[model samples]
Target: MNTVEAPIDIATEEQSIEVKTDNSAENESTNDTSNLDKTEPVPIDVPENPEKIEIARLSSIITNQTNEISDLNARLAACQQHYETLLNRQKEENSREKQSTVMRYAQAEKAKLDSDKRCEALATKNNDLLKEKDNLQVKLSEFKLMNTKLQNAYEHKLSELVALKKELEKTKEINQSIDASLKSTLNHLKGESSHLKEQRESNERLKRDLNEQHELNEQLKLQYKQLTEAARAIPTDDEQAQALDTLRNEHNALKGKLTNIQDENKLLREKLKSSDEDRLALENVIENFRQTTMREKETTKKLYDDLLAAREQDSVEISRLKQIESLSNQTLADNADLRQLLEKEHQLLELTQKLTEKNSILQSDYEQLQLLHKGTSTDFECIQKINEEQKSQIAKLENIEKSLRDQLKELDEKYQTVNKLYEQSAKQYDDSLSEIQTLKKKHQANTKDLIKQLQQLQKPKFTNNSNEHGPMLLTSPTKPIANKENSNDNSSSHGSPTGSFSSLNEITSLAVPGSDHIPRHTPAHQQQQQQQQQQQLLLDEEQEVIVNIVDIDRQKLIDKLLKQQKLLVRRNEKIEFLNDHIQLLTQDLQNKRKIIQTYAMNEDSFMYTSTESDSIKQQLANKNRNNSSSLMATLYNRATTTVNHTTNKLFEQSSPMTLETALDVMGKLQSVLEDTLLKNITLKENVDTLNKKMPIVKSASTMSESTTNEAREALDCLHELSQLLNTGLDKKTLTACVRLLEAGVHPDALAQIVQVLRSETRTTKL
Candidate 1:
């Protein structure tokens, strides 16, 4: 009876445990609904003749099963705690993954921003390069125009020089003829002067002879007079008659000699008159020759002055040629610089491409990180679901077998779907990769074509330059030869014009801006020919140097461009290789992620499946024992369920409310409150300032009417004045009004002045 009572006491205790389990089951999640039906109490039968040994065996068995149940419950509790810890760890890992992903995303964004900035900078650089190219092109056009003009000017100067040379030759011929004629005239004049001197000496000798003959005639007349007187005194004798006869003969002979002498004297006087006339005519001819020579000298001097002026013009042309050479050199340097800038632009483009590729890679990495973060989050959720399932498994051990099979079917279906998705993704990835390869090949082909086109385009330019320069180079040497010939001819022809020519040369040399002048020798006339030859040689050398420098610069630029092109190609190849590498890495990362996901899913499925089998076995064993000890088994299950439910609830509620979490939340709230307080203080200060200004505003508005009216009137007048000023008033009138206003004249006075000015203007118009 006591044993039977003991069973009844056990039944009452079982009733209390069942009531507790019912309470716990009600508190548990809806997942345990199927197990709730099994918690109902089964009626117990007490035997009238109960055996002590049987009761003892039953009690002992119940005690042993209860101990096993308690142990299993403890183990389940430990597993639940471990699962909770694992969930917490998983959550922390997910949060950390989230943080890392966010950082990676931020880094990617920063890189994108940097790339954008670089692109903008490159765009600006491209614009600047374009502007420079335009400016250089304009400069080149100007240089071409200048070159054409210079060529025309040079041709004109050459024509002028030829004309001058012809004129100089004509003048030289004229001068030579004039000099010969003058020599002939001078010789004739000298012969005529000598004839005149001889004639005069003959005339003087004739005059002296006539004077002697006159004195002898006078002495004879005196002797004849004395003889006549003596004859008158002596009378007539025969001897005296003979003497008179002799005297008469002598008288007749003397008279005959005197008559001949007088005729000769008359002839001499006539000869003297003729000689005087010839002398006067010769003197007049000499004066005429002198006048002609003076005129010829003046004409020659004018011709020389013209030649010197032409030389000065030639010197100016030479200076201009120097300027052209300098400009050409500058243009060549500019072209080289432009080429370098173009190469830099190409490099910048390559850099931009590389940056774009890197940005794409970073974007991919950021996406991958995001996917990983998502995967972790999903894994965490799955783990939480698994933990919840584990708790439900503990609570509803009876239905675990059925639920496990369905869950396995679901998991299998999910795995199949995941596999299908992975396969599809792999196929897509392969297709994309193939497309990328094809695109790369096309791009490479296009780049090759473009390079060929560039080379083709450049060939024409180089060929044209070579063709043009060939003629210029050929022509250049001939220019100095021609110039030297001209100088030699000028030096040979220009004898008497040396002083004026030298002075003109000095002036021309000085007129050459920025040209270094060689100091002139004292005997410049002697050195002129040597200096001309030297100048010709210098000009030839300078031209050769210019041509060579241009050619060298062109070749250097071409070489540099080619080298830069090759470098760019190499860099492009490297970029392509790096891009391929990046693609491969990205593919590998994706594969790794897929692999990790597969591993996680497999682990979850294996864990879930393994637990399902154990739970099912346990349920089977419990079912077997239910026939013999249903009441005890029910009580044990109730007790275990209650403990598990209570523990799970406590852990689930406590997990999010740790000391650290509470502190973090409190700190956030405190910061928010502080921000709000600061905002409120700022608002209050703004309101106070507004309030303080309100009174002042009101007081000003409440000012005396007379002053306010005056102020308003002044403002109106100013506004009207502004409008009038804008209405096309003449500057003088406007300035006068401004001055009147500045001098503190009233608006009325200014207005009256303006009206008067307007009236005056109207009157003038009328």
Candidate 2:
């Protein structure tokens, strides 16, 4: 009966301990549920869709926590009922075994003390759980704050988008206005062009009239010179009078021709005035078009910039969202880790239950031994020492678990920081790549536009130059046909013209009765006709020479333009190569930085090249500020200088430089640069190999630093040059100057020629 009472007491104590543990778990779950419920909601006056989703998630989390807590409470209540039942059974046993009640009571007190110690341990565990829950609550609060910030950012983005839309609408209106202006200008230009064509025809006719007047003046001068010579040989007063009559008749004919020439001159002057007015109108229209195009370009650039800014903002927001998601995931992981810890604690409770069962078995064995040999008190004290050792071991394990948990938290934080850094780096890389692609596309488009503009500009110049040659081109085919017709008519026409001249001479002779030189004067008139025919032949030859000179000049201009285009293409290629190199260098630097960061993150886990890492970091920092831009600029400068040197050298060797020769020279230079690039790449590989083979970190670091610095400087130079390239060189007048320079023209000569061309263009425009 006493033994049964002892077993009942042990069972009651075990049940009480189980109930205590369940109550502790219930308390912990309750605390977690309360913390979840107490989590602050995002402070928003007007919640959007995202806010609603977040609120729903939070509510779900609270409900889940509550349900878990309720389950724990139920478990605890069941444990409490079991403990009560066990306690009643022990009380009944105590009543039945009254003889050994005092010993059983002492054993019960010991069990109670053990149970109290375990309850204290459980309370500490519950406190740790509460602390974890508090940490979770803090994280939730931080998440909520982040959400609020994101919402604010979202609202700001929406506002910005709306503003952008308004700007777009305004731009559309402005574009419409520009289009309308363009259409009006185009119509105006069309009218001007038609008027110019009519004026051109009038000018051509006036030129013919002026040529005729000039021939008449030459003929009159020759006749006067002949008459003065003949006057010296006058034989009598009658002959002089006859000469006077003949001179008077020639003077009358000259006066009538002069009057006709003056009328033509007046018409030419009136046409000139009309043309001047038309030119001024056209200039105004051109100015208006230029202004409108400039405004359009400005608006388009503003829109592009705004779009890029918006894209960047979106990317930033996406990065932020990703960061938030990572943080939330980390929190969930931590929660999972906490759940695992709780599960382990539950497992420990089961182990403790098993140990208690074994303790009960040992106690029963000790009781049997005490009954067999009444001196087992020392053995019981030994069992107590063993139990104390187990308790110490359990305490050490708990301490180790706490240390492990702290380490896990540290590792998690480090991982999160590293992840953030990696993400930021990747984002920057992607943005850079995207920006580069866009810039390349823009460059191509701009180049195409420039080419088209150059072609358009060239067309007008060609047309203007060709206008002077138009009549020559047209007359070239008709001249032979007219000459053939003239040859066929010459027999009949010549006889008729001679007979008329003879008849006029007779009439003049009869009218001047006592003249002896009338026949001689008829022969002199014939001589004048032969001289006029000779002058006509000379004029035709002079016109041909003028046409040849014009053709030569046109050819030279075309060749120069072609050379400049080739040079521009080579320059563009060089720029593209430099850009690619910069991108590659940037990628390499990013990769190295990533590696260094990873090394730094896992410093304890692996050996790291500290010197190399430090050098790389220094290089990166320098590149970020000014070195990169300077490096790019220097590299571009070097390439351009090399091209200039090569071109000059080739220009000297080839006295008559052709387009093909210039193109070949440029290709050679490009190849040389490519070879140099390849050599540099090979050298880099060799250095890397050497570094791998031998730990010459200082040397490697020094080399890398130098290379990085140079690269940075080149980048800077390239950026500055690209800016200049974009801003400068828009004027059509500059094309000739650029072409001359590219064609290896002497600067002084080029300047003079450009000035002359510019003046000529200005005159023409006027």
Candidate 3:
């Protein structure tokens, strides 16, 4: 009996330990399950002692913490509002400042306009002074020429005076000779001496008139000296004064016009000095205007730079706002999803609580059946009592088994339901995750595209800003907010409050692990559920991490896209600018071509005229050569004839001379004539040769002109063809044409037509 009792005791103790272990394992599983649930609260086992009271106290502490979190959230909302308000105020202030800057710029522009007007006026005055100076220079040159002529005239007059003085001396010498002769006659005849005295008296009167003419010459010399002194004192110089003197002398004899010439010279000198002063003043004014205009231009550039900076800042701020709005919307969506997950978890918790309550009732029934079996066993005989106790125990055990079976069935059904719900939730979560991923991918793509566009737009602006305003400081406050990490604990704690409250009682029931003494099915099922819950929790955590990663990736993608877009935009702008530049260059090239064409036409015309002139010159040279040849030929013939005549005369004069001598002289004359004739014919032949080359040269020039005209016509036709092609093609076709043209096709349209034919052939073959 001791051995049997010992085995039974060992079995009972082992069973009890196993039960305790199951309860402890269930409690541990519940804690892990609750942690993994993300929404359901963990159930605590209530004790019949002070431990239960401690749990209540702990519950109150959690409630207070929740209230604090709520208050913090409200405070955070208020702070966000305040920050938004400050941003708005700053924006308004910036706008006001921008307006003030614009006003200042306007004032500066007005000042610039006034300065420009002044500059224009100064330029006009300078131009007028330049004209006056040019006029003065012309007059001064004319005066110099006049002065030169006057000096020449004065030299001629002095030479004439010297010649007149010499003539007077000769006449005086003749009078002296006549006087000597008269004295001698008086000695010869005393009566004739008286008549000679009367003649001598008449000569004395003629000498007195000559002395009066000499006195007039001395007065003219005195006037010339006075004019020279006046000319020296005036700024016009003696040369101009000499010019005036010659003019006055032409109208009046020298004594009457010296004072008038001096006065005119003084007036010219005064006017020249005034003109010089005016020119100097105008130059100074022009210099001042140039300096002021330079300053105004600098100021205008500064204002333009500031305006560009302001506009860029505004664009950046607007972009930031849009990003912030997108992030806020994403956060709201995440919160809604989290709320739904929490509600589902709360429902699962309530079902678990109901299963635990059913287990507790089955445990109570099993204990009562054991008590009744114990009490009946002491009142009966061995076999009968054994039988009755067995029967009653068997019935009670059967009822308890049935109840356990019923509870087991209910637990299994609930387990299945919970499992189904979990599977559905997981599926839903997976679907949501897939949808979110898809949306994220699409959003990333779209964001990348948008960023690219924005970047493209901003690049030129940024480059322009950098060029215009040097370096700029850019501040982005939204970057910090967007990059902030979400706390995992906070995300788990903020469950749907309404769902938690509705399932509060069920949560309390699940706290007692051993209150239901059913078989260990619930523990095993709960363990499986806990594992599933942990897996779901892990998935949720992974999804959160994935979401965060996706967000970061998306943001990175957006940034990359933006950068690409900016690069593309900048490239596009550069391409457009290059195209514009190319267009301008083409226009310039066309203008140059036109200029070249005009030059070619002019050159051709000039060459034609020159060729004609050369022909005329050749003709003139030919005529001159012919005239010279003819004159030489006639002279040669005349000489030949004269030689022959002389030879014949010589022969007649000396008939006795030998026949060989006369014949030799005739032969020499003939040879001389032949040589002269040969020289004349050679000159004539050279002139004829030159004349023949002139027509060939003219014909060559005409051929060259014709070639040039043909080349010009070809270019014009090519240009017309290009214009027709441009008009015939749309943008896409034009682009194709351009590509074809670049590829060296003479006619882009022909190349396109060929391509179309090839494509059609291919299609027909297909």
> Which tens-of-lDDT digit does each residue in 423-467 have in candidate 1?
657756875696568656755665566556545544423223323
Better of 2 and 3 by TM-score: 2
Model 3, TM vs. native: 0.14
Which whole-number lDDT from 0 to 100 does residue 58 have in model 2?
A: 75
Best by TM-score: 2
Candidate 3 overall lDDT versus native: 0.49
Off by over 4 Å in 1: 1-206, 241-245, 286-290, 320-766
lDDT of 2 by residue, 342-442 (tens): 55554444443333333343334332322322233344446558767976997798689779977986897699669756865775687569656865675
TM-score of 2: 0.25
The TM-scores of all predictions, comma-separated, are 0.22, 0.25, 0.14
How would you encode candidate 3's per-residue C-alpha lDDT over 1-766 as one tens digit per residue?
A: 2222433554575576567557655765675566446434434754568666657666865775576568656755765565445434333343354345434433443344445555566556556655756675675576566556655765665576567557657755754665465344334333323433453465456457546645766665577667667767766666866766775564365334445545654664464455346434533543454454455456556655655654565565556556545655655565565555455544443443333333333233322233333433333235445656766876798679779877986897689668756865775687579757976786576556655654554433332332212111111212321222223333334433223322432332242233234343444544433333333333333334433433334475577557756765776687579768967986897699769857874563324443223333333433444456432122212211211233323213322334664365345445645675699899999999999999999999999999999999788657845764645444654554444444334564344343443332332332
Q: Judged by lDDT against the true structure, how good is candidate 2? A: 0.54
Between candidates 1 and 3, name the one with more favorable lDDT: 1
TM-score for candidate 1: 0.22
